[model samples]
Target: MTDRFAAFRALHHGDRPLLLPNAWDHASAAALAARGHPAIGTTSLGVAAAAGLPDGEAATRAETLHLARRLRGLPALLTVDVEAGFSDEPAEVAALAAELAGLGVVGINIEDGRPDGSLAPPALTAAAVAAVKDTTPEIFVNARTDAWWLGVADPLGQALERARLYRAAGADGIFAPGVSDSDTIGVLVAGLDAPLNVLHRPGGPTVAELGRLGVARISTGSLLFRAALGAALATADALRAADPAPGAAYPEPPSYVEVQRLSAPPGAG
Candidate 1:
């Protein structure tokens, strides 16, 4: 646990910002691991949507746990986006953290955003972070503040305030997902005591630019999952349109055998 935690922490301090891609399921995680990504994070949106539940409302705790348990044997470090810790009670959240830690999960992302579109009280969120650390000291608790994401006025100020509280509560990193501007990101990078994580927007700063802004980590959040869904719809549309003559050039996908191999046990031939 200590070694895995240390490796995840080290990724934040590398020359370039750690490109932490978020995965939805076993196959997605295994594919990323096979591509040599050092770590993989579970997307809360993907988990919730895949289960036909809503995200950020604490509605997918069971699904999140099931995915975490299944992902434990993969060859990469795993961090889970357990939306709002799935409960407001610190003890319950801590218990969840302990469970994930036992499954070899090295990190977790807990947000302060509520489904009602309000930020959770900073003190309450801080208590949750403290509880998780107390329960499993080795798990990297990434305290997330969605001030910018909620479109709150003075989002930077709100985020900075939460950052201080969560960091003092023993968070290893701070994630502000909707902060996209260079100036705000640089300020967060300088102001936060722990590593600052920003979401990677498509048209916004590239990974290299974010690295220059001193971001320690860049999260894809649910972009990959959403993109996959979009691609699937587009492919279906193309297939239907090409039914008469099949003239369109279809995109090649992995063979069934290759996808089947992804589900095999790590040591199985």
Candidate 2:
């Protein structure tokens, strides 16, 4: 609840949407910060996959905390995706939020989607949002309702209803992913009192288009991680096939020395 928190909160109100790139590990986070992203988010899928766990099952609390500890030293604001807060209990979720806030985290994404393909009850989600705000008022809480993501009937109606409850319970922003249409995004931006965040799709709409539709924040959730994985597999396949120009499809990676420098401790060589 200081400059970092305020700065992160302020990003949502910028003239353009705050383009937040989600990272899986320290290297990705550090690399994005070095590339001039003022804020970075943790992709729940990426984190769980990296730890050999499943995402949205509340299974990666320890892994998330460990990564947060490692990322505390990065030169950027941090927002963690605590998938459903790793627990349905309000106090438990709030405690996790407080812990992340203490570790220099500025924000968190708490989604209502469950592992079993159901959305949490609006009351449960609201209680968690309220508890987190009570525990750490300064941390930005981007409450996520996965109505569209889970493909529920009346997705927009369900999302708006749940978002209202979360906002009333003290959520700072409302994120409804999987709704990529411009008209729908505009309705969300116009309907909600809090900032509306959307997920970035490669061919759906550009960042500028989202901004034009009044999106406050745009997140690349798991896109970078999946891309990196695909690139690695493609490179391996090319080499196995003895094909020429195997590296042409991917961007050039950082030099070995550059990576070593990035991984070094503050005073270490």
Candidate 3:
């Protein structure tokens, strides 16, 4: 078997940031793999919302693990968004990471945000990173801090502080979502030691612009799934507007995922 953990780790160190698309399930993952995404991630929001479960809570451990199992045989490398490892306990989170690694997952994104709209103690995320690294030793731990998203003052400072802790604890990357400006993002890329991951917001900085800022990873978290939902509704609206549901060859834009896939993250090099 390939050392996919190492392979996925290397993707972050490339000349360009790895543009990772988040998938909801096997079909999505497989479709992404078929389209040549070398690495793919699972969106916690997509997984939970698809199953009628709440996201950012400890409600989707079973669903996440089941999705991991189904995607184990997928062609592309996979990382899962565990949403704070699905537990406040470090041991449980570490156990979950180990199980995912055993299921052929290459990486995990463990955030520090709580479901109740506040950030967890940074120590919890740090300890989880330490424990996960101790157990698996190879899984790419993308330690996520919700400082910006949680509306904390000095988000960059707090994110950097928490990132330092997680890196020291064995995180391979630092993900700071909701920091949108170029200057702030560049500052983060400069301050952090590990690869910096930014969530791709629609109409925000483009991939090339972000790569120029020295980011190493870009994640389309829940966007593809949400876009699919919108697309389904749009298709229905079109059918409702026409008599007899007339269909035409609509090949104008690429598939939803393909649009992102084509942009591909640019290289800082």
Candidate 4:
């Protein structure tokens, strides 16, 4: 295996967009890595909900750190989604980034989405990005914009402005979630100086389409984790409703014992 951090960074600029699949736990991440994913990212929603914490509320800092420590030993490069950097203070966010870097994390996705479904002040987010980069210059900072996700009418303008500020603040990439239309995607791909990371939705353009439009990265941000949850529920419902029994065996679901072995935390096996 290559140096995961350096290899992960190099994967960003290849001819095709890096189809980054976000995992919620060590098993999900390791399973994906076993299937040949070069790098793995933690989804904030998955991390928070698994711990019974609310997402986007900055309530998962400890959970996030613990997950990072567990995931650092995985076979693939690891990137963590620190929702809104977990605070408004730049120094606090930077400190969190430094800790992640020290734990062998190579990349981070910090969003501007707030707990109230709005965006944080662009300046504040940019400051946080700069602080993180300053503290860990080698760590990949992916500045995320939630303009379209929050129904901001001027999404293009907001994304462009935030992208500019974040790039100036040393962000290595820009993630514009909820942006899948060809026109807007094209404009953002052309405008941003950094690599553009878009969320891949079911009805959205294919990977080739995004690559044709010049997108550099495609993140399945919470989509896979949520889909996995939905799939499990659907299987259970089908089995419950079936007269005899539905064919929803669900592959035996790997076993609790196997899960324990895969995710033995940092110590205490």
Candidate 5:
């Protein structure tokens, strides 16, 4: 367990940034593991929407834990996104982290953003991070700040301040999502003590560019899940518009047997 935790932590210190693909379920995680990703994360939005719950409101704690349990046996390291730790109480959040750690989860992403478009006070957020670290020292807590996401005034200053607070509170990594500008990204990467994480945006800096700017981790938060949804809708539309032909050629979709294989454990009958 210590070795697994160490390996997951080491991924953030490589020559290039670790590109973490967020998975919503077992199949998504298994597929990514098969594709040779060293680590995988859960997107809170995907988890919430799949469970028919609202995101960022601490509504999917059960759903997130269930997904983590399902993904425990995968080859890649698993890190869960427990949005704001799913409770304001730090001890409750620590208990949740301990549960996840017992299930072979090596890390978690906890943010400081509230559903009502406000930031949790920095000290409060720090306490949550501290509690999780105090309870489970092996679990890498990726502290996330939403200054840019919430369009706060002076986002750079706010993110920097929060990053410092989170780092002081023992965060292993700092995630500033929605911070796409190169200058701001560079500033955070240079200023932060822990590994810096940036959200990957389509039209923003490419992974290579972010790597060049010294980002230690690049998370595709909710992007792949959203892309999967978009592709499914487009495929359905394409099938509806196509003329019925005996040998019509369309994009080859993964077969049912192939998808079923994703659920099977290695060496299982």
Candidate 6:
């Protein structure tokens, strides 16, 4: 546990911003791991939508746990996205964190966004972070503040306050999603004691730019999942229009035999 925790900690450095690619399930995670990504994060939207549940509504707790358990067996480090811990109660959120730790999860992203586009109280979120650290001491608690995403009051002030509270409560990192400005990101990184995690914005700053701005981690955060959804729609439309040149081409997928081998009985050839 110490080694795994150390590995996760080492990934967040001043020189390199950890580009964490978010995955939806086993296949996506395994494929990313196969491609040599050091770590993988599960997207809450992906998990909830895949299970026919709405994201940020505390409706996919079981599905998120199950996905985390499946992802923990893979080669890369696994970080589960527990949407606001799936509950308002701090102890319940801690229990969820403990369950994730028991499943060998290395990190967790707990957001402060409500179902109605509001932010959770900072005190409640602080208590949740404290409880998780007390219960699962080794698991990295990335306290996320969606001030910008939810359009909360005074984005910077709100995020900084929540981040301070969370850090005091033993959060390992502070994630301010939907913040892409270099100056703001630099300020946040300079002000916070814990590592700063920013969402990867397309056409925004590059990883090098983020690293220069002192961002420790950059997450895709459902962008890939959403892009996949869009690609699927485009592919279907192109095929219907009998124009194969309108969409991106994909490589030949694995056969049944190879997929079956992935789940072959132990010691069977």
Please tell me which predicted candidate would have the highest TM-score against the true structure. 2
| Regions of model 3 farther than 4 Å from truth | 243-269
TM-score of each: 0.96, 0.98, 0.90, 0.92, 0.96, 0.93
Choose 1 or 3, whichever is better by TM-score.
Answer: 1
lDDT of 2 at 263: 75
Which lDDT value does model 2 have at 94? 98
TM-score of 2: 0.98
Sort by TM-score, top down from the best? 2, 1, 5, 6, 4, 3
Question: Whose lDDT is higher: candidate 2's or candidate 3's?
Answer: 2
Tens digits of lDDT, candidate 5, 1-269: 49999999999999999999999988999999989999999999999999999999999999999999899889999999999999999999999999999999999999999999999999999999999999999999999999999999999999999999999999999999999989888888889999999999999999999999999999999999998998787777766878465134445667899899999987687
Q: Lowest-scoring 10 consecutive residues by lDDT in candidate 2?
A: 260-269
For each candidate in the order shown, give its overall lDDT on alpha carbons.
0.92, 0.93, 0.88, 0.88, 0.93, 0.87
lDDT per residue as tens, model 2, 87-126: 9899999999999999999999999998889999999999
Better of 1 and 2 by TM-score: 2
Model 1 Cα lDDT, one tens digit per residue, 1-269: 58999999999999999999999989989989989999999999999898899988888999999999999999999999998899989999999999999999999999999999999999999999999999999999999999999999899999999999999999999999988989889899989889989999999999999999999999999999998888788777777777653335345666899889999999999
**Candidate 4 segments exceeding 4 Å error:** 1-3, 243-245, 248-269
Q: Model 1 segments beyond 4 Å from truth? A: 243-251
For residues 1-269, write the lDDT of model 4, one tens digit per residue.
23766787788889899999999987899788767888888999999999999998999999999999888877788999999988899999999999999999999999998878888889999999999988888889999989988998798999899899989999999999899899999999889898999999998899999999999899898998998998788787877778264543554567788666666644455
- In candidate 4, the residue pairs with backbone N, CA or C atoms under 3 Å apart (3 or more residues apart, or in different chains) clash, namely none
Clashes of 3: 0
Candidate 4 similarity to native, TM-score: 0.92
